[model samples]
Target chain A: MAGSLLIELDRVEKTYVQAGVDTRVLRGVSLAVGRGEFVALQGPSGSGKSTLLHILGLLERPTAGRYLLSGEDVSGFADDRLSELRNRHFGFVFQSFYLIPYASALENVLLPGLYGPESRRSLEHRAQELLARVGLADRASFKPSQLSGGQQQRVAIARALINQPAVIFADEPTGQLDSATSAEIMQLLADICTQGASIVMVTHDEETAAFAQRRIRILDGRILDNGGPGPAEG
Target chain B: MRRALRLLPRVAGFALDAVLAYRLRSAFVILAVALGIAALTVIVTSIDGANRKALEIVDMFGHDAVFLLGGDIESRAVGKRTLTLTWDDARTIRQSIPGAYLAVPMRAKSNITARFGSRNFDLPVVVGTTEGYAQVWNWPLSEGRDFTAEDVAHGAKVGLIGDTVAQELFGDRSPVGQIVFLGSLPVQIVGRLSYRGLSGGGGSVDDRIAIPLTTLAQRFNLDRKYFRAIRVKFHNPEFMDAHVENLRSLLRHLHRIAPDQPDDFTILTADQILQFLAMLRGGLVAFLGLTAGGAILVGGFVLANLFSISVAERTTEIGLRKALGAATWAITAQILAEAAMLTLAGALLGMALGMGLGQALSRLGILEIQFSMKVFAIAVASALAIAAIFGLRPARHAAGLDPVQALRRSEG
Candidate 1:
């Protein structure tokens, strides 16, 4: 499945300098995600899982090593070019369901499209479609505060799909939800994966990681094990 | 550039949402800016009114006329009377000065009571002058005839009453051919002067009566040897300044004053009155202009501080926006758009407030405020400039925030 890889990381390294002390977050991390593949990064606290996700999602640049998206090296891209690529190709869902507190669910879903090439009139229609797909079409005009934890996460998922990105990067999408709601969110993510969009999710729970076909475990700043490939990784 | 243009409306909508979300903070900025803009508008409009009034005064006091007033105007104490000017001086200026077309000597008294057929009113002013007084002052009678030189030579009791006196003393009846007693003497009304609304000094210009100079001297018990002032009209108003200087030297020569001694009379022109008005306006401008500047500065300072605090408070939001693929320039543009919109609203409110006061002052006859599109343009441009100057720092700070660190801080 690596023959049609959507993303590739070759010895990526990230370092943070704080108070004259260097903290290595990701060291010599090499990974790849095939098109439509579901991958879960599992690690304990301080395992640098979130940092790796951020670098993969283009929110931050690695200190060294090459990052390839669609077989093209993008590690040396400028800030604006990187922003353009992220807008066109990547989506993110944070742990806190980071919807604009003042905006409605539909408005939150339309945010990504606002920065993309689509016109707002067309984006509105697509945002409604995405919200309906997430099964909260009736709550389109509700603010984030008015929704429950599971409902808010669903809205966040709808927003992540607004721009029709090639890959979705979700950082602990259900970390704050109960077991039952967490299972529901995982099922929704699984359903989305089946629709031909790759997903890279970070979680500490084994049950959550079970939803993904491949699980990559990390400790300290290095990958402990890249879980054996699933049937799609052939 | 094209992408930024397309994203402008979305960014502006985001900005408006933030502004609406924090209503209290937004109102604080709007109120501060509105007060400043209102004060500035009032001051600017008032200055415009003062300029218009000055022009009206110059227009009323005939552009080509030079008034030679009795008493040392530069040195005299207020209300102290002088009687050095005479008809002889008027004769000399009209005969000697090359450009002098006609010089009309005048004597005036205020608070005179006139009576006619049991109706009486306290007239504001009564003037006594020669036959050329009507022509030199450019005041044509609306009805009847002007008094001739023969009337002045004979000290005739005929006079021209102003519209106010005619209306007050005779109702709808014709004032001509009627006799109105001036104090204790009966004077015949020969004509009615035209209606003139208000004087530059804000008193009714139509409240005065005109009579022969000799009649005032004999009937009013004034000294026949001297008069109050002499108004000299020049043929060429373009060269009136030179004519005024020539008249001043000639008056000094005729009065036989030594070069060291100041003349007891003052020469006045429309320019002198306008200069006096400008000096008065200058004091008002300095005081009011400083006040306006201080208000604007305080308003800008408050806006800048509040924006900085808002940016600091929304760190997580900014991070989320960046994560959602918003560029650095988009964040900056959103903050700037918020500032511009708030100030624009404030400018409109301020204009309405100031114009309200302008209408009141205009009604009170204190000033005549000129309402024009220029004022609107100035207010808007200044508000946008303030938004640019004060809103830049906070917008840049928000745009420069590190997304990863911002998100981490919020996670706690």
Candidate 2:
């Protein structure tokens, strides 16, 4: 919070009500990531890693505590404003590689810029450049189904970079890939971080977590350790 | 604004592509909508045409025309009394009223048998005035001449036959200048009238025969002083209420009736006939409306079901769009646009089919089909409204989808 932190969570808590019963998901979670920091979150399933990621990504609001994005308190913001913040400031890559099946690889990569003021010509060029950076330029016109699993993940990575967001939130980016493909995706994500962008990846794979500059582990909705070596070779 | 407009066509194109992807199912839905619209259009147009035809029949008797009839038949029969209006009263109305144009005396006799050669038929024969009959009533002569003042003055034995009478008596032969027997008297057929076909009342005036008033009064031994009724044509139709009031006061003074007593004679005006026709048409329109409403409701159900299935099939697509930074409004707008586009397509196609069917019916001489602009507007507006009404819940369901659950479901 002292040095222009890009994200700050002040004792954030979330409780979900189902069937008239309250289940507490996050309990007083406080965290921050400064500009250009690659922070990896590692935890077992149901440890609230995904819940914390959702709150950080502005997809959900915490029931209690204040959340700030780039120094602006966003916890009480309206849905539209939160959506705008998510669009302008963050990119997401999911485990399922949620690319629109009907759109081509280039269209999928260029989809995020459609809501912004970017010209079609410029967006197309940027998408091509990103696809080439990910070494799938020739597969730009292929649909997600026509591409291999590794290639589809590559397209997802390229899409995550299309808006040039301040941070990319990759939740299990390599969960659906082989070891070699996982390594390739990790390398691509690390390269994106090197280009002065931040990344916050949530993965259970210790090897994948090791590629980040900082690794944090959580248990029972609370952080257990920080500044630990992950399983990935660095 | 320009970007939004550009997106409209793209969104519409996507909608069309989606519909085309399921060609058979979409086609069936479109056909269903079109059939409903066509039925509604035909009923509305046919009823409207019938109303117009009825009005035209009333207009044939002249504008602002009123028929003064004696005491109600049921009341007179029940009370065992005789009450009638006289020719003196008709003359008084013509002379005293400032707005009155023509006050023609009429004495109608029912169940008269007329004969031509070997053929014979029974029809209602109206014996009316000769001098002002054609002019006051605006009856057009299809063939030969109408009764002249000389004919009525001299009580000439000449007559005008309606199309139905001429057809029945003469068959294919021309009845003009021929002699037809009317109640033991041979009356020369001087003219034949054009067929004034069946009006909304289900009665045709073309089945009757018209003769001079003096001839029927003198020869047939009908009541001379007390004619059956007086037919008064007025100059202006809008002043009918004022004229009716004037006629009532004048009649009360002439008849010496008490102020509180009911009128012995009732005045029937074209306005009353028009009102009756209007009510009839309105009822028919309401019936058509109820049917159309049901059709639209069922169409809406079909649309809602289609949209629900569509949302189910595109859960993953909705999630993808959300993850790509699409606003909720944008997603909702896309689904609404698809519904509207489908309904609009159905409406246009339906209108075309309706007009075609109307034309076919017209060709068959069933009705004079008129394509009203108002009907077209209503059809299109209702189609769009139905789309919006039915499309809302499904579109909202699609828009409110949780991104995580949606993606997970798609993967599963």
Candidate 3:
């Protein structure tokens, strides 16, 4: 890593138990994402790529392994502490752009700030600024149902950045968008990364993965290669 | 803690949005809660009215006075006046009981037509009593002088009219010295009694025409040997119990009743009146309580089931919130806030509905229901308690959902 490390996974493993059967989801996986680094995890379906993304996002716990954020091991943190860390230091974007259907674009962007220590006035101003940044300033009052899929994803992206997290975990952030919209969203993610927020994105599309500076390939819950950092392919 | 406080308004806003989004589900729960709270409000008002009526009766009937009705209190049927007591019984009770200072014998008939000129008022109670009736009952003539000893002794056809009768037949004119017909017998109004608002039975106490006992008996051809009731006043209210016992035994001796035989006459004091009122209140409370409880249980059940369905439907939303860094308690608080808001809306609706219904009943003379701040407070508190009890399970379910699984489930 050329910069200060933001996320480090060491021999991370996950197992799920259902009806007296132990199903191993993730085998030993090791990876590192540095400050302002844009890394993409690429794999086929059932390759445990999504599961690894979940662990990295703190949405799930690794059954056995050490997970470090900013070089501090957080595998043993309590659920509440983990939740606080998630609120203060981590952001997420989903393929479906999970915006609250009842809330407007501006309200959705302000969601993460509600859980943090930010004042309402400042949070509201930041949300409007982010909406402008995502080029949805005019549609800030539009609801999810009223907005297009691309616009909804932009709102989700703005929401992720509200808390100024250290890392943005995006799982197929452009899966539902057209090729043109996907490129736009990926370019926006690259721009956010260059602004000093690290991004660890999960995508199976080669074209989407090519937008990142580095690509990590996962198969059968293990990382096959952590690619060398270089200029992203156009 | 501080973060939760800061998030309160946002969470409340989100909860309100969720409630508004599921209009039909929210309506069902709100309606159920409204009906339950309305029932509670009616019961609370009725109980308050009954207590107030009891107090009014006690105030009028006097603390040192005892009512002796001719009928047996337990077997007394409505409309059939018992004639076991008499003027002689009143005289004997006054002379024999040491502490009993005054006893006034009276006979009364309801719905009697009282007429002055061509104007007539029906439902006016016609009371036949002696000269001492006013003094013993602690009532004085508001306009004219009370009947003298000569009026009772000579069986003079003089009478006293109450405020209602005076207003009805005489308008604003003074009723004193005016002749009024009690059924067929014409009598001059010697006095006008003061205003007495409402009776315990919700009937106006002022719609009465009091006449001399001897004259009423002679004109109506009623048995002079027997009368309807007696008002006994004690010299000291402190020894009321002892005085009542003495009068009871004296009456028993005079009536020549055996020890085993039940007394035909019933003695009712202020305490007995309160006890009777309490008994009526107990039955009313139990019956109304069951209805209110059933409504509340059904309401709570509907609220719980609907909340569960709401949670299940919003699973993805819950996951999205968690992914956005909402803690478990935050999610729970949001759901609970939704429930609380719905219940509060229901309680307000119920209070309005109940007050409207209660006012209608009172106006129609069907029932008397009192509305007060206490009733509103109680109804709201009960509704909130129901929300807390029923909302917890669904809130906990929402809070316990794993964010990853929830999101994945939605994706599938």
TM-score of chain A of 1: 0.95
Q: Which candidate wins on DockQ?
A: 3
Give the winner by lDDT.
3
Ranking by TM-score: 3, 1, 2
List model 2's recovered fraction of native interface contacts, to 2 decimals.
0.30
Clashing residue pairs in candidate 1 are none
Off by over 4 Å in 3: A1-3, A229-234, B75-81, B200-202
Q: What is the C-alpha lDDT of each candidate?
A: 0.87, 0.79, 0.88
The TM-scores that each candidate's chain B achieves against the reference are 0.90, 0.80, 0.94
Worst 10 residues of 3 chain A by lDDT: A225-234
Encode model 2's per-residue lDDT on B175-197: one tens digit a residue: 99999888797889888888877
Instruction: Give the Cα-based TM-score of candidate 2 against the true structure.
Output: 0.77
What TM-score quantifies how close candidate 1 is to the native fold? 0.92
In model 1, the Cα lDDT at residue A79 comes to: 78
Clashing residue pairs, candidate 2? A206-A231, A207-A231, A207-A232
**DockQ-based CAPRI category assigned to the predicted complex of candidate 2:** acceptable
lDDT of 3 by residue, B1-412 (tens): 7767878888898899889988998899899899999888888998898888888878788999999988687877786457888767888888888988888889876777988899998855688888777787778778888878799888998998988889999999999999998888899998998887775453687888888888888888888889989999998899989988998898888888899977878999999998998999899899989998998899899999999999999999998888778888889999999999999999999888888888987788755798899998998898899899999999999999999999999999
